[model samples]
Target: MKLVAGNMLWTNINKIPNQYNYLNESITCDVLVIGGGISGAIAAYYLTKSGVNTVLVDKNIIGYGSTSGSTSILQYEIDTDLHGLISMIGEKKGVKSFELCKEAVYDIEKIINDLEDDCDFSLTECFYYATKASMVSSLKKEFDARKKHGFHVEFLDKKDAQKRFSFPVEGGIYSKFGAAQIDPYRFTHALIAKAVKNKLKVYENTEITNIYPKEEHVLLETKNHFNIQAKKVIIATGYEGRKYIKEKIVHLLRTFTLVTKPVKNFNGWFHQCIIRDNNDPYTYLRITGDKRIIIGGEDEKVGGINSKMSNLSNDDLVSNKKYELLLNRLKSYFPEIKDIAPEYQFSGLFGVTKDGLPYIGEYKDFPNCYFSLGYGANGILYSILGGQLLRDSILGKDRPELELFRFNR
Candidate 1:
């Protein structure tokens, strides 16, 4: 299924062409990871570092999937509010999820520093601004809940928020920590390079058609009729794995993004902060190092396993409409933008679970098969944490966060 049609951030940075064809014969590995996005790459990296025989495969190049479409805003705040999260899962579990997200942010920072990647990694202050008075109280409640959970957050009134941020806003909550931004494509490519250097085998342009569980190994069938045998398998194919795990709670939502030409004197409104609002189908904005504005939003549920559709395509008009709407919103909010028309426009799909919590851990009844999905726009941070969690699980290490995001309860 094609969620995004045109070239995106991932495609723009993927200049080096490398393709791994389908497996021609049976192959074995200690651990096999499916999908070559940030999650799979990081998972392979960690596993290989632990001396595990790991193999990573993807139908296309690394970052060719949803990773290319990501806006790359790394923030601890989730799309769902803290209070809402508490309502979905118990307060204790909700708080645990919140802490896991915060840790994920730190994990990314440490990874970038260790890898010495030149990706545009920057520490950003994230804000959830209130557009209407009704949302003001809700935002305040979230602020209080977050603080109660030991997070560093401050409530900013309208005047204070306006003074701090260049953008026109009424009030908001500011978190000085657990927020960051990066060029996801570059980060993913760098991680793949590191993984390769660590002796992790990766296969691109090869799609896995079926997976069968055997006595002591799992058999993976590629579209080219090649077979792979591995002791364990990881399904990190994003929304593509909804078919294998029949959970209706997860919804595949389509979102569009556009990057405009760098605005002169656009010293950036939030400085390092990834800006967003507290609104349904929320909108997020951030300025790149080159001074171009990157805006993303307009989420609509298209199709997944529950839908009647058999195949998905990116050539839909709905995606184009959403792209235009996003551009118009950007122009309206920031009139200083020279040209509202974006230099590039693209759409990508993300899976959102009903509880707004990612599902990570072993699949039910599949002893050696694991799955991580429904991370939404927070895939980068979660991918980092998920990789470590998967690695620890394989190494028989204790990871407390696993209880909060395990699949099938």
Candidate 2:
């Protein structure tokens, strides 16, 4: 479980035009968004589309934060198992929360289609397979819960699953709906582009240093000593919001991924479906359009950083060793592919909440401030839903989903 700390997939997408200069003068907007990752960008996009004057600022280059590190498997299936969720939050709330995630996947597809974003978006079925005999009962229980909650799922035997997908598995649960894969960078860039085209102000490389709530508005201070005043402020700064949330439950964990050179025999090994193992340090595999196999997993908590020597530079042997292990695992699972050497290896960190659900909605103490954090693996979908929810709340409209994702709930 060596953790890597870079994003290879997002680094290849088109870059958005950046405004590197820091905010030097005070400005006013209907809404101010912090963090330029997928969540912030989508929030600005939705707010602007609603004709709300919006300003978005990021500490670094837009999409360079946790969004870039995402494996981008846009599925409603969360890091927490359904049975666990039901046990923790009662069946009614648990089922409702799961429905929100299910809706998020469909909502994202509609957004991409309606906007006609050229983000390499594709419809794909996501599969969760059991890698050990001990996991079979849990998998079945999850599958049954999904079915009871009205999700489209099918349980498959090892032979049937192996016949359809080349990956090694003991058994699996396939959900035909509520899943997709997209180039996250392209998606973020597209949203920012559209938001800019609609006259939303996006300031990249403009880091916010502090935020203070005013009588009727929120005041944001930046590293360069610039101030911004907005009626509503949204913090989508990912794990960096630890200071504001003041909760250690938002733990940071790193995950590694490797993309191999395009293989002609990819069809024999994969069928464009997203695959994940039902294990702790679970492995997820997907085939890109160019037939490159993208294998991701090997996650470790941030405290485990020393175990893998990830602190070493990119060309150092420590880095090579991490990638080597990932490649070896890929070969072990899909032995039919030759030349399994990876073309690229990268890693990134994400924040996880104690309850394993993203923190969304407004801060109880500060009415004008909204927070979106702790989207462990489903950041893309949550960002979309969060953006819409934040916008609705800011405009004084009712959003029923807010109850489940609120920060102080």
Predicted structure with the largest lDDT when compared to the true one = 1
Each candidate structure's TM-score, on Cα atoms with residue i matched to residue i, is 0.92, 0.92
Per-residue lDDT tens digits for candidate 2, residues 201-310, read 87877888778887799888888888898888989887677678654556666677888888877544445678889888888888766677888877656664464433
Q: How far is candidate 2 from the true structure (C-alpha RMSD, Å)?
A: 2.7
Q: In model 1, what are the clashing residue pairs, if there are any?
A: 124-272, 125-273
lDDT assessment of candidate 2: 0.77
Q: List the pairs of residues colliding in candidate 2.
A: 6-347
So what's the TM-score on candidate 2? 0.92
Cα deviation of 176 in candidate 2 (Å)?
A: 1.3
lDDT to native, each model: 0.78, 0.77
How many pairs of residues in model 2 come into backbone collision?
Answer: 1
